[model samples]
Every structure is written in structure tokens, then in C-alpha cells.
Target: MLSPEDVQKVATLARLKLSTEELQQVSRQLDGILDYVAVLNEVDVSNVEPMAHVADVANAFREDEVRASLPREESLSNAPKTDGKYFLVPQILETA
Candidate 1:
């Protein structure tokens, strides 16, 4: 079982703000989670093969076909704000 101090340390590391009651509750819950992991660690996997994932799958990406893009005026038509030739967005970075 995790101690109160240990629970407090973990909460601090995780940036959590907990009351005394919540700390006690979390300590018990964390102990249960650790105990469950200990049980899993005891399972034998000597015959099992290591894998990237449990399932075998591959991505099927479509080929890119470069063609004509939307006209500047058409693309800017739906924008909430636009300058004559381009999209007008709020300045995020200041110029040096």
C-alpha cells in the first residue's frame, strides 16, 4: 500500500491539488493499480514473440495527383476575413 507521503508526492508530481480525504482515496486506488500491474508482471511470456503491436496492420495511402488548385478569389470567398489576394489572419508573431 502507498503511504500518505508517497500519495502526496505523486499528486505534487502530477500537478494535482487534493484534499486530505481525496489523497487517502487516491492512495488506496493507486495501490490497487500497482498491485494489478504486479499480478500482470508475474505472467509467463517466455514463448511469446515480441511485437510492435498486438495486431498486424498496414496503412494504405492513396497516390497524390497534382492538379490545378482553387483560384485565389474562390478560396478566399468563404474566409471570414481576407485581404485582396490572401487570407487576412491575426498577427501571431511580431517582426524583429
Candidate 2:
């Protein structure tokens, strides 16, 4: 359970400017959320094993193989500008 003062401090840290009414509302809502978490903390889980994933899954993969690719000249021919083998574009920044 958080005090109203504690809620106000949190609001300040979060850069939120809440009116008195809104502060009260937010304090109550945060208290409710904390109570729910407290309830969850009381659950028994002694027999449960921790796991990263819930499903029983196996790795599915495909073999890597080389495939034919278009010739460099043909590929760059459609570009608006190119530097022989690669596409060219304007510089993003000026050197100092």
C-alpha cells in the first residue's frame, strides 16, 4: 500500500502534473494494482519448473544453398544513379 504522499512523489518523478482530484484517483488506482500484485505473491508454486517458453517445440530449419543472382550491371542499370557496380546516393552530412 502506497500513501498519498508517496503517490505524489511518484507523479513528480514521472513529470506528471495532476490536480488534487486526479492525484486522489491515481493513488487509489495504484493501490489497487499493488493489492493485486500482493495477491499474486501469495500463490503456491513449489512444484512448478521455470521455463522460457510454454510450448514443447523443436528447431525447424532449412539447409543453406546458393542460388543464381542477377548480373551486377543488369541489376544496377535501372537505378537513377550508380557507381559502376553499386547504387549511388547523396551524402547525408557535410564534413567539418
Candidate 3:
């Protein structure tokens, strides 16, 4: 069970300003959470393997392969600004 002082100390560390009523309410809530955790601690899981997730997970991406790409002219056709060979973006950095 968490005392009101314990909850107040945590609130102070977290920079939370709780009224006296709020402090008492939070203390009771935290104590209930701790009690639930204590109940969970009693469960036996010695044979269970630790895992990152419960479901079996696999890579969902398509296989990577070299493929044909759009021709340069077609790729550059939709650009708002472009030179003959490359896209022309506005200069953002000041040079030394």
C-alpha cells in the first residue's frame, strides 16, 4: 500500500501540483495498481520463454531486387524546377 506521503513525494519529483483530495485519491489508485502487480507476481512462468511479443512475427516487405527504373526525361517531367540533367531545388545553406 502506498502512503499519501509516498504519492506526494512522487508528485513533487514529477513536478505535479495535486490538491490534498487528489493526493489521497491518487494514493489509493496507486495502491490498487501495486496490489494487482503483487497478484501477478504470484503467477508461475518459470517454463515460459521470454519473448518480445506474443504473436509470431515476420518481415512483411517484398523481396528486394534490381529492377528497371523510369527514364530520366519522364522522371524529370513533373518537377516544378529542374535543370536539363537534375532537379533544381532552392539553396538552403549559407556557405562559409
The Cα RMSD in angstroms, rounded to one decimal, for candidate 2 relative to the true structure is 10.5
Whole-model lDDT per candidate? 0.88, 0.89, 0.89
lDDT (Cα, tens digit) per residue for candidate 3, span 1-96: 777878999999999999999999999888888887888787899998878776776767976999899999999999999986899998889899
Model 3 misplaced regions, further than 4 Å:
44-96
- Residue 83 error, candidate 1, Å: 25
lDDT of 2 by residue, 1-89 (tens): 78889988999999999999999999999988888888867889899897878677878687888888999989998999998877999
* Model 3 lDDT, residue 42, Cα: 79
TM-score of each: 0.45, 0.43, 0.44
Q: What shift in Å separates residue 49 of candidate 3 from its native position after superposition?
A: 8.9
Query: For model 3, which pairs clash?
Result: none
Task: Tell me which residue pairs clash in candidate 1.
Answer: none
Model 1 bad stretches (over 4 Å): 44-96
